[model samples]
Target: MKLLFLIVLMYMFDQHKGNRLSNNPRPFEDIKREISDYSEVAKKIINLAVYGKAQNRSYERLALFVDTIGPRLSGSKSLELAIQYMYKALKNDGLENVHLEQVKIPHWERGEESAVMVEPRNHSLAILGLGGSVATPPEGITAEVLVVTSFDELHQRAQEAQGKIVVYNQRYVNYGETVLYRGRGALEAAKVGAKAALIKSITPFSINSPHTGIQSYAVGVPKIPAACISLEDAELIARMSSWGSKVVVTLKMGAKTYPDADSFNTVAEIVGSKYPEQVVLVSGHLDSWDVGQGAMDDGGGAFISWEALSLIKDLGLRPKRTLRLVLWTGEEQGGIGAEQYYKLHKMNISNFDVVMESDEGTFMPSGLAFTGSDEARGIMKEIMKLLKPINITQLFGNGEGTDISYWMKAGVPGASLNDDITKYFWFHHSQGDTMTVQNPMEMNLCAAVWTVVSYVVADMEEKLPV
Candidate 1:
């Protein structure tokens, strides 16, 4: 087999007239000569990068995906439809070994909800129940509002919060910090004897829009009604709190959790011709929030990845390593889809050479990141030479994406296509996370970067280090 592969490599090198090998009269000497033809191979890669820019397949496919799948909040009928849509699309893209990996997912439903500041100002406030938050009693809970700026302040001012709506007027900051308030603020508020809790929206900028994301209830603490108020309303409450004037708030949240449901991760693969055992994986989650058709949060991410692979297949550029794509389910609900997938296919991890993920909101392509050895970092840096035309030079030496972190932990070198995240947090986890958030030209440019880099990784002779 080794002898046959060497002979074929030599024959292809001679046929392509690579470097000095084409001029050599001796066949055996060409084998040694072709070994140093990395420059010729690099040139082909550069040409593909330029070609990718002209193909607008990614934008066309993204529009179609949004039109078909729509919003895909976890466990909703829309999410179920997304599974089917992605499965069919993968099969149509000429990917072999297409199948679903089953996963048990939680079914949290958003029901009726309403909020209003009953005193000082009698106007209804925009509100949405955070995912996993228990609903208020059918009659609802109305109490005085006791606002605090931070968790430390809440603990210090527990006297003011007694039997009142302890409104956490914490300002939104970076995702690493702001997300903590959304995830654990409710549980902390319940630790005290507050009637209920209302949180300021977890976004930096908004036009009277309430953002909702998942929150957890501690094991022994009493679970109370919690909802996010629009930034505009939150500021009003903050002002009233500063004056030491009594603030009354009425919160009616109607969210509930049903029994577990069944879902699947849609998997597709373009098989390798020479080294089929090695795999290069790329993916995005297919599920999104129920509100506003979830076009930016993930629909764009999934479609763009699919489009990149589709371009490679269309170009008839078969790789030496298998290129796999997974449209995942249940990412918004705390990485359930990724965890289930890792467990179901743990054995296959050994064969995975590299895995790339794109979960960031659609923005102009800034660059790529890596989570592997220094050798792999050097290889990625070299590969970027081919991608320089696409404006994708920013590289992180030790970075991993949320969805593919499982693979990286298991030793599969992982990378994420880093998009411009400057404004991502504004609409993330909110009703504003729609397709309208994207600029079509920017999306296409990002897809072009993915196409070139992914193709090079697939076709390269050496495996991604580490």
Candidate 2:
């Protein structure tokens, strides 16, 4: 494979050399000039990000935010304080039009929870109640365990699942496939008269740490206690049951849901010099789950977005269209804050030229996943040429972040920073999500890419075609 790839590369290079030596060489000068025009400013952005290493500031700020405010769960007082911190910080940084937009968010608390193995040997298991799950009775519920690899298996053994604790030992395929059990395992188990559901952490690898995430109960289905157990525990129960050994477990939870609480989406901007009404928006969610410090999952994303605006502002560079930064809340609860923002500002949706989000962890810059028209793609291709020095040149199509999907559906262009996501799922929504997972250089590179993209797009003469 390597030799074939080398041969193909050599052939391509020789073809390029042949074309360059031909008398009828293509007019590549014009394209080079266009790239240079954007590259001039792009160089400065990269320098600022590289030399300044803005990631250090972002990391420190995230550390402080995590230490001081910690776990910005939607509707929690900590989340509210985090919003206030950013609101004041943005204003103090001299960003224009800094303010907060109100959003009501669901408040769910995981009071106390535990799972224990009773039969086959008494042992305690690591567990975390799935967000939005109902509580077990005050004493708890104990039943024999019924393990299934998929919903199909559960259905096949529906009769045996009655009055048992359904254990989903589904193998980790990919996030999109494995997450089905986390999102609907309880509902599926309830349909078969199970007393409770225990899911293997949705991550591909684990260290006896359970990952917790939001789960939704289907309407008209019975609600039951659902939680995640360490991958080891899930496998242990699966093995025991496979040996025809009776495995019984006891589950107890004090989880509760309260009335919706008030929150806000913090907004800041650098008004455009030519067209103030037209906007280029970049954002990341400010809220996270109640587990880790929320550093890698989204703290890095949020701070890098802020750092992009800060870098441009410090350089005194103003785009032709407004550059707006929105720190969203309730994203962990399914993009509640972004949805509200869209509804409130959708009337002027046409004014938005592009929307970009960075929810994926800030590892290293690969490129961007973009969604737009062919004309817009052409424009972006030329613009991305400016990023060649930083090794970011790919332009993927038909991909956008959850928070900006609505805007893209409304005919606005959308983009998301593409990076090395190999380890992202390992730390995502788990206690492993912390500042230790981030690197200063990689985060600065991300900030540089975001700054250049937002600035150039906002300054371009033509709006992205619909």
Candidate 3:
């Protein structure tokens, strides 16, 4: 009977991996039977995470991690300390193959920065200098303000922008659509000879908060100071400019870009019981903007991933394929660590089955956004069904994340946790991103889903179709 069961399992994996279901559709009952084993494991995971002793563990861990090591910006000394903190934490957790791989990353400091209205009004404007922005002169750059809502308007009034400070008050559409202004506001402003650029915080909702993010400089174009201003202040200046108000502002930023610094991608894993060479990768970047505690931006995501491995270990369950966790560095400054990881590991791309990243807020998880073939989606759907106990079982088609997109584009199956991120951008790259934005119960649910999906995918005999 045992021999027959093994033979049947091999046949099932063989048929599924070979994509035989395309020509031959099996009955739903057979599908249920095939996934029944996973359902049992999922129940155990839910119980451990939601009800057992591990409840709220991820949230507590995240709080400790972030509280101990506040914002971990790229190439900062605090970031290096944050890496050591995780290195010790993971080893203490009893995870196997714990180590770090060096990756060179950029270093930029947000020195003393401030902006104030000198003419028309003397109200101090809330500001946070964009990363990689050059410092303004010690005396500061006081210029006439040229308020424009979009790039087109800037081009339309190019003559007015010359020698003026361009304040971009672009309306909030969405993060992806609106964040472009934050990234390129300075480059565009410099084109028309603007001395500096101030962008409105890219959030639909804000309580007088100034956000900061990375800004890229074009080759051969003069670099100008770029910073994010509070929505209220930007709108104030824009409204003043609209009513024929001459709003002169003085912006001072001590920002500077140093040479590249050392960094590492912290790693830990559970070696497979069977095929140790095959890996199911899970990740969250450890680096964050030098703002608040960074609990919401990524501390929650990183700890939940750690919780996944911890839960499996506590339950004494090892998957058939290795489940590797990578805490990436330098993600905020444009995926500096993950990009190197991809270049280093792409040669063994076939060995990687799935790459999962959680850059989006770790709010109450709803389901997953996945990128893969139809057959792979079918497998993912079955796995998600096991998460029904947590009341999250819907899978979306578009799987997108900054760190994991590289693997997805290269045809490796990718998955990103789908959660209620309606307010993700509100705290993103800002001081509002702290433990107050995270819920313990929500983190528990997210950890459960992350663990269940990663475990089942690793243990399942069938390989996800590339």
Predicted model with the maximum lDDT: 3
Candidate 1 lowest-lDDT run of ten: 16-25
Q: What are the per-residue Cα lDDT tens digits for candidate 2 across 1-466?
A: 9999999999886543311122433344554465468887898888888775453676677777777877878878888889999999999999999999999989999999999999989999999899999999999999999999999999999999999999999989999899999999999999999999999999988989899999989889999999999999999999999999999999999999999999999999999887788899999999999998898869988998999899999889999789999999999888899999999999998688899999998998798889997767877777887888788878887658889988998888899989999999888888888878888888888888888989998886556666
Model 2 TM: 0.92
Error of 3 at 450 (Å): 0.4
Per-prediction CA RMSD (Å): 6.2, 10.7, 3.8
28-91: candidate 1 lDDT, tens digit per residue: 3342343334345444434443344434456567767777767788888888877887788778
Candidates in order have lDDT scores of: 0.76, 0.88, 0.90
Prediction-by-prediction clash tally:
1, 0, 0
| Full ranking by lDDT | 3, 2, 1
Q: What is the TM-score of each candidate against the true structure?
A: 0.88, 0.92, 0.94
Q: How much is 203 displaced in model 2, in angstroms?
A: 0.4
Q: List where candidate 3 sits over 4 angstroms from the true fold.
A: 1-32
Where does candidate 1 stray beyond 4 Å? 1-54
lDDT minimum window of 10 residues, candidate 2: 17-26
TM-score of 3: 0.94
Sort the candidates on TM-score, descending order.
3, 2, 1
